[model samples]
Target: MKGNTNKIIWLTGASSGIGEALAYELSHKGYKLIISARNEKQLILVKEKCKYPENVAVLPLDLAGFSTVGNGVKIAIAIYGRIDILINNAGISQRSLIMETGLEVYEKLIIVNYLGTVALTKEVLPHFISKKSGQFVTVTSLMGKFGSPYRSGYCAAKHALHGFFDVLRMEHDKDGIDVTLVCPGFVQTKVAINALIGDGSSQNRNDTATEQGMPAEIFARKMIRAIEQKKYEVYIGGKEIKGIYLKRFFPNLLHKIVLRSQYR
Candidate 1:
């Protein structure tokens, strides 16, 4: 995965944040990229910023729109004949309490963050199975490791990703398929501002924690190393990443801190 000139990598949510940073990082490594996002214009900007702009293509995709995911997959395949890796980075966050949130927001989160990712992977599964070589990379969050304030739905969706991908890795191991579940604690991205509120509207404001989180470029550099090493699971971020380990060795300690932690 390092300095591979012909490898094809398809990535969703490439319009901004970690995905955008990855476009540049992988481009520098000389990988052909099929970058997708709901915004074609922003995708184009990402492609232009790539080290090898000619090797990148903008594939507009809407994960929430199941009907369009398959088409996007086909177009991505058309770009490089086949994809060596698929990065599921397309997701939305939540920024409201469970009681204040509506059922519709939870449903949308499941649809886009969980089902949509699964659907895209399935569309590309046949290709990977036939070749018996490919990687599935998902960008989950630290919240996936433990429940947190103001993110019940987001946490549920990410936790579901862990369950689904663990099964995928186990079932496909014999087929030589690799899965990397990346749990990022937090990064300086617009995730907080774009998070859905109780009424299913965007939060429209960035939180202090997000403003001071790790830069997406640094996070992407570390991510590329983990991907190249073919890690099954890894966590990246600031001190918050420690929460994952704490949850494992000291459940009660983690539980107490998480409940009182004001993520916003």
Candidate 2:
């Protein structure tokens, strides 16, 4: 399976961080890729850095622009004839208290992280159903399973993703569609620096935990292995991954631990 080069993947948020890392890894494995993000230049740069640049195509996509997703999907399909997998990795993080966060901020979070992903998935669903074999690998966050301070809107958006994708898997498994929800904890990326603040502006700073988290390359390797294995769900991170179990078995303890940590 690792040697199969015919598989084509459409990966969103391919310009940076985990998406960028995933692009490089997939290219190394000889998968044809159509990479997308709002930043065309960054996407091109990422594609150029891949091991097999010839196997990569760039498609600039803005998840917030839901109306354009149909056209985008058409363009993506034109590049590869069919998309074997759709990686929903483009999303924004937040670093604001709920009370201070504006309604607009929450709306943008929902649009980009939840609704936009849903829109893209819906656009691709028909094609996947027609093919009777396709994968939806969504990159959510550990926050999706539990809560944290200063990430109220972000958590809510990620939480919604879990709900939507879970149902998608249940509804489409008969069609041979697979859904893998990858919930990542902090990684050494610009996510913290680029996170949205209370007024919808970028946070413009890094969080301590994020700076000290696992490197993107390492995280991508583990994630790719999970994808190759076709796991239904995988949580990748440091000790933070344990939060999933904590949330399940000891909600109060998890709350106390999260409150004490006060991560931003």
Candidate 3:
């Protein structure tokens, strides 16, 4: 009824990692939540962990299934009549060099990461437009801002989100629609383990950098603060966030660092 209190928040990829942390964080702040993910079992577990479990709804969704996301959003909306925020935090990562990766892997990454997010956003856009008030929060990566080895396809997908959402923010400013692009460098999660490899198979291995990344709970806390402030774009991470600035001022230096990274 005041500020973010009692607002309805629809969050995707809510079963694990940053999404899971956010569920708890937002629930404690008194937001009614719709949590979605591919795994219903895990989603239920996340829901039960929330401070206000009764305020949460679990909707299982697979990002790759484009046609299904629309229905997912519809179900989410029915829970609270309207949704004040939609968080597009669902996506897959790549862990193979472009040359080693198959075309199908790139296609799959685009479908699940780029197109899937777009489809869901489009589904929710009409609702926001009708209300003339809503916020869209997308979780991209530090990789979105620059090129990185072994993540060619993943980088492409994230870059596409930046382009789409930047345009959306501009076009919908008069409609009072807010967009936040979150660029996270690394957080201790299973992302590396679940990243797609050359054949579209999971890498199943965690990179050393991922092992040394920020805790997901800490990242979620900062993210919630950014959302509350309605920042257009926010970066979170360790030294990796500096890459965004480095790419702007010292492109050659950042390129060299990327080439020398353990990724290669």
Candidate 4:
């Protein structure tokens, strides 16, 4: 992959999982990284694990607090001079059926997963536009393309990202701003355990499918390659990733298969 050593990349949700893994991958490739998450200590730990710790900065942020994201980006720009890439990887998930889910739970998931990401993207966009060069790498999900049982809110949030970022890519393409939406089928992240339940409570337990999902490091490496190629959208995972195409080309068969899948 082509390395952009001078590019400054700002990544959220860097405390663990795919975000942390990407920090290591990108840092090793020589990109200056600014990592953010609500967990300050964990963000520091991620920075320490980077090949070039001196090139990584830890910025703790809570995506749920969308109003403050602009200030956070301002602080990051102050430190890095300019941000060449914005990776919106911070998001929450839902692990309950819609009927069993509370309205507040749905709203919270939307706020953290969709709205917060959009807000942060908007915050960094002006800088990109002025410079006429930047990339926005969004970590959505395969759920964005196909709805699954027990994840109505998560599916909704992920689907919304597609609509939002797709438009951003079209509107800003001429400005040299590229947007890549990454939809992974099942990633072995703590997402399942951290997923919100119907009553707005954490599941606090990993699901079987998630346990068998792709490793974060492997996922991150593929993502880096996709970003380098400037692909507008890419799907990554194991066999499950094939569902994206199946869902598009053979809806009925895909529906039947998904309905009978053990992951549901």
Segments in model 1 whose C-alpha atoms lie over 4 Å from true places: none
TM-score of each: 0.97, 0.98, 0.97, 0.97
**Stretches of model 4 off by over 4 angstroms after superposition:** 1-3
Error of 4 at 231 (Å): 0.5
TM-score of 1: 0.97
| Candidate 1: tens digits of C-alpha lDDT, residues 1-264 | 355887899999999888999999999988888999999988988898898899898888888888887887888888889999999999999999989999999999999999999999999988899999999999999988887889999999999999999999999999899999999978999999999999999999999989999999999999999998999999999999889889899999988887777777
lDDT for each of the candidates?
0.92, 0.94, 0.92, 0.91
Backbone clashes, candidate 2: 0
143 Cα displacement, candidate 2 (Å): 0.2
User: Which tens-of-lDDT digit does each residue in 6-118 have in candidate 4?
Assistant: 88999999998899999999998999999999999999988998999999998888988877888998999998899999999998888887789999998998999999998
Better of 3 and 4 by lDDT: 3
Model 1 CA RMSD to the hidden true structure, in angstroms? 1.3
In the predicted model 1, the residue pairs found to clash are none
Badly placed stretches (over 4 Å) of model 2 are: none
- Ten contiguous residues minimizing lDDT sum, candidate 4: 1-10
| Model 1 local distance difference test score | 0.92
The order of the candidates by lDDT, greatest first, is 2, 3, 1, 4
Which 10-residue window in model 3 sums to the lowest lDDT?
A: 1-10
Candidate 3, superposed: residue stretches over 4 Å from native: 1-3
